[model samples]
Target: MLLSGHCLIVLERTVLAASPAEGCALLIGRRHAEALWVQRIWPCCNRWEPASERQRHFQLDPREQLLAQRWVRERGLQVLGAAHSHPSSPAVPSLSDRERSLGPTLLLIRSGLTDDPHPLRAWWLPEPAALPGPAPEALPLPLEAPLTGDLGE
Candidate 1:
């Protein structure tokens, strides 16, 4: 989940905008020798979780996931990871989050959005065992320069 500071800021804004509910998106980027470069943020609607359950859970619509996968491929990139808001909870994954974990892909959670630190955390579910060695985890993934200027995208 190596991304520019610009992407981080964007994620923060998105989560805050959707406060009280879970905001979800796809982190698409290319793989580099030193890191997974996040080149784009694909915001997707949380489709499966009913409106009432959104405060605590998120379900990336299968349709959106397919579309995002296609879009990432079109850009010559891959699904580097996923991002979602945790509402008022801490940035730690809940038991349900772990139970539903697919393992391997970088999963980012933004929690405490209504307070200081507004933590945006990352984790490596089970490590991509197919890789030659232990692939680097999402955290400690270097933050690159801002992807844009204040002027706008």
Candidate 2:
């Protein structure tokens, strides 16, 4: 149900390992009138690797891509969108990010130290068309630990 303003959507181990330090994006699909929801999370690729001193780019490996596609197809879920993280930069897509975007996909960018022992700032990528039409608005998804403290660890 569009879990807005929340980081790390509490996924299974399979999904988490696929996207550890980089970042992950998923397209969630649900029936129009049902509570059941399914997601296909994929790792965002860092095309600008090397050029950014190994700090500016993050790209999905081939294996992750294959798994993402398979997850969507097997689950019969329509890829609603994609997501990723900034690691050090803000949780917003850079110019290169826009250039590499696919369609009207939902992109999630996480920012902060992954091992800092604290939550990080997470934002949703606004629809490309929404950029020029009006002030870009991003959905803030803060990461909070569940009460159970079971972050799939």
Candidate 3:
């Protein structure tokens, strides 16, 4: 996926802002040829139920998602996928993440390790039931930061 440095910064800040809780956003952009260009990110509140599981789970506000869809449609962009932060884990997707994914799309996960040179990672996940076996491993996608060398871990 191709993302600008500014967008990366925005994603990091938005997700990290949640600190102990998880934060999420929708990736807004266009898909051209084989590349997905992330034009922007729409930050969303983590509305996971029970409140206590917010640290390990996230649910985009339905209202915000609808609004974001409208905004993207108006701008001729698509909601490429979703993004979220793992406040206490690595940039890799957790089992829960993979199990919950509706996929065949990109997923960007940011690690809590701020000091790490590359704290964010991207993955391409298949549909949950696309295969009959155990959940398939997510395919890693290289996150290219054109102006900033600060992504992927």
Q: What is the lDDT of residue 96 in candidate 2?
A: 64
State which candidate has the highest lDDT: 3
Give each model a TM-score: 0.80, 0.56, 0.85
Please give the ranking of all candidate structures by TM-score, highest first, separated by commas.
3, 1, 2
Q: Model 1: per-residue lDDT, tens digit, 10-121?
A: 7777665776788888888888764678877888887744688888888887898899988877878888777888887877666666656576667788885457363777
Tens digit per residue, CA lDDT, model 2, 13-130? 2233433345455545554452323333443444435534435555555565667677777877765555555556665567766655664555555555455442333233455655
Which lDDT value does model 3 have at 70? Answer: 95
Best by TM-score: 3
**Every model: Cα RMSD to truth:** 4.4, 5.8, 4.1
Give candidate 3's whole-model lDDT.
0.83
lDDT of 1 at 103: 63
Query: Where is model 1 more than 4 Å wrong at Cα?
Result: 113-118, 127-138, 146-153
List per-prediction Cα lDDT, in the order shown: 0.73, 0.48, 0.83
